[model samples]
Target: MGDWLSYAPSDFLLFSARTYYRLFELYNRAIWPAQILALLLGLVILWRLHRGGARQGLVVAAILSGGWLWTAWCYLLGHYDTINWAARYFAIGFVIEALLLIWTGVVRNRLSFQPYRDWTSRTGMGLVLFALVVQPFTGPLVGRDWRQAEIFGVTPDPTVLATLGVHLTVDKRPPWGLMIIPLIWCVLSGATLWTMGSPDAWVMPVVALGALGLAVYRLSSARGQSGIRHSEDS
Candidate 1:
C-alpha cells in the first residue's frame, strides 16, 4: 500500500504516446475540410476585431461555442473516451462552456468587442495569430507529422488558447466567467502534455497564466481610475 501511494500521476495515464498521437491523426482525418472552415472563421473574427465590429462579441462567442461543441462531441466523447475514461468529464466541461457562451453572448448580449491599440489588445491579437496559424505548424516543426497537427476549432488546446486571446481584447469589462473553463483546461491540458513528454507542454500553462496576469492588472487599473473619479466628484 505504501509503495502504491508513491506512484506518479503519469503512471496512471491510460494511453501511450503512440496511442495518443494516433488518436490525433484519426481525429484530424475524421474532421477533414472542417478545419479549413475553422480557419476561415478565425480570419473573419480577426478582421472584425481589427475593425472594431459592433457584433464582434456575438460572432466570437458563436464561433467559440461551435468549436467547443464540436470538440466535445467529435473528439472528447466520440474518440478520446475509448481510451481515457476521464475524457467524458472533459467533454461535459466543453459542452458547459459552449452553453455559457451562447447564454451570455447571444441571449444576454453581455459580451462585446471594442478593440483599442493597447498592449493587451496587441498581445491578444498576437496570440490569436499563433493559435490559428503558427500552432498547427509547431507540431510539424517539432517533428510531429502533419497528420498529428492540431488545428484551431478542430482541437481543444488551440481553440481554448484562441478564445482566451479574444477575451483579452475586450475594451470594456471582460467576461471573466467565460474564461474560467479555458483557464482550467489550459492547466489540465498542459499537465497531460507534460506527461506525454510533448515539447509544447509548457505553452498552454504559460499562456494561461500570462492572460490571467494581464486581466488582474487591467482590473486593478480600472478600479484605481474609478476611485479617482469618485474622489473628484466628492
Candidate 2:
C-alpha cells in the first residue's frame, strides 16, 4: 500500500510541459478565427444573462452544448488524447455533458434563467469574466507563448469554466446534476495542470470548491422554502 501511495501525480504524466503547450499552439493555428467567434459568444452570454428569459436560457444552453461538442472533437480526441490515453474518456464525458444540457434546457425546457442578485450570482459573473477574457491570457502571463493560450470555445478548460459561471449565475436553485460534471472536470483539470507544474493550477479546484459550497447552500435554502410553504398550506 505504501509503495502504491508513493507515486505522485507527476509520476503518471506521459508528456512534457512543452509538448502539452505545443498542442495548444498547433490547435490555435488550426482553428484560426474560431477564437474570435468564441469570444463573441462569451460576450453574448454575458449580455443576455441580464435579460434572461426561457428563450435566452435555451440559447445559453445551446451555446454551451456546442462548445462542449467542439472541445470533445477538436481538442480532446483530436489533440490531447494522442498524448494522454484517458482523454478519450474525457471526450466522452464532454459529449455526455453536452447532451445533458440539451436535454435539460432545450428538450425538456427545465432550466429557468433568471438574473439572480446575490453573492453567488456576483461571484458567478466574476467567474464568467475570468473564463472569457482572462483565461486565454493566463498561460501567456505565466510566460508561455500566446500561441499556447486556451480559448473558451476552442478548448475544454475555459469552456468548463464558463459553464460553471453560467450555472451559478442563472439558476436561483441551480441544477445539482448539471453542476456535477463540471465539478468533476474541475478536479481533474486542476490535478493535471498541477502535475504539469502550471502556475494557474489552483484555479479549477478552487472553482470546484466554491461551486460545491454554493450548490449545497442553494439546495438547502430551496428545501427550507418548500417546507415553509408546505407548513403554511397545512
Candidate 3:
C-alpha cells in the first residue's frame, strides 16, 4: 500500500511524451486524405444543422457512427494498441459507442437535428468548432509538431468532442446512453495527457464538464416542457 502511495500518475505512463506525440505524426502520415474528408464531413454536419430538419438527423447520426468506427479501428486497435495495451479496451468502448449510435440514431431513428437556438446549441457549436479547428493548434501552440495534430474525424479526442457537441444539439433530450463512452473518454484522455505533463491536459475534461452541464440543463428544460404540455392537455 505504501508503494502505491509513493507512485504518481506520471509514473504510470509507459511511453515518453516524445513517443506519444510521434504516434500522432505516424498516424497522420498513414491516413492522409482521410483527414480532409473527415473535416469536410464535419462541415457538412454543421451545414445540416444550420438547415434544421428532421431528415438531416439520419445523415448526421450515420456519419457520427462511422467516425467512431473509424477511430476504433484505424486509430485505436490498429495504431494506439501498439503503444498502449489498454487501447484494446478503449477500442472495445469505442466499438460499443459506434453500435449504440447506429442502433439508436440509424435504426430506431430517435435522433433529430434542429438547433433550439439556445445555450445548448450555442455551446454545442462551440465544442464542434473547437474539435474541428482549434484542437489542432493546441499541440502546435505548445511547440509540438503539426504532424502530431489530432484531427476531428480521425483522432479519438476530437471525435469524442465533436460527438458530444452533436449530442448536445439533438432535438430530443441528450442521449445519456450515447454520451457515456465519450464522457468517459474525455476524462481518461485528459488524465492521460496530464500524466504526460502536457499543457493542454485540462481541455478534454473541461469540455466534458461543459457538455454535461448543457445536457443537464437541456434535460431539465425538456422535463419542464413535458410538464407544461401535460398541464395544457389536462
lDDT of 1 by residue, 32-149 (tens): 8889999998898788778765587778788889999998999999889998999999999999999999998777767766556578767888889899999998788878889998
lDDT of 2 by residue, 10-88 (tens): 8889998899999999999999999999889988888778777658878888888999999999999999998999999
What are the TM-scores, per candidate, against the unseen true structure? 0.95, 0.93, 0.95
Q: Give lDDT tens digits, candidate 3, residues 1-234.
A: 999999988888989889889999999999998999999999988888788666687788888888899999999988899999999999999999999988887888788765657878877977888888899899999999989999987999999999999888887688899999999999999999999999999999999998999899999999999999999999
- Name the top lDDT candidate: 3
Clashes of each: 0, 0, 0
- What 10-residue stretch in candidate 2 is worst by lDDT? 109-118
lDDT of 1 at 170: 76
Candidate 1 — what's its lDDT? 0.87
Candidate 3 residue runs with Cα over 4 Å from true position: none
Runs off by more than 4 Å, candidate 1: none
For each candidate, the alpha-carbon lDDT, in order, equals 0.87, 0.87, 0.89
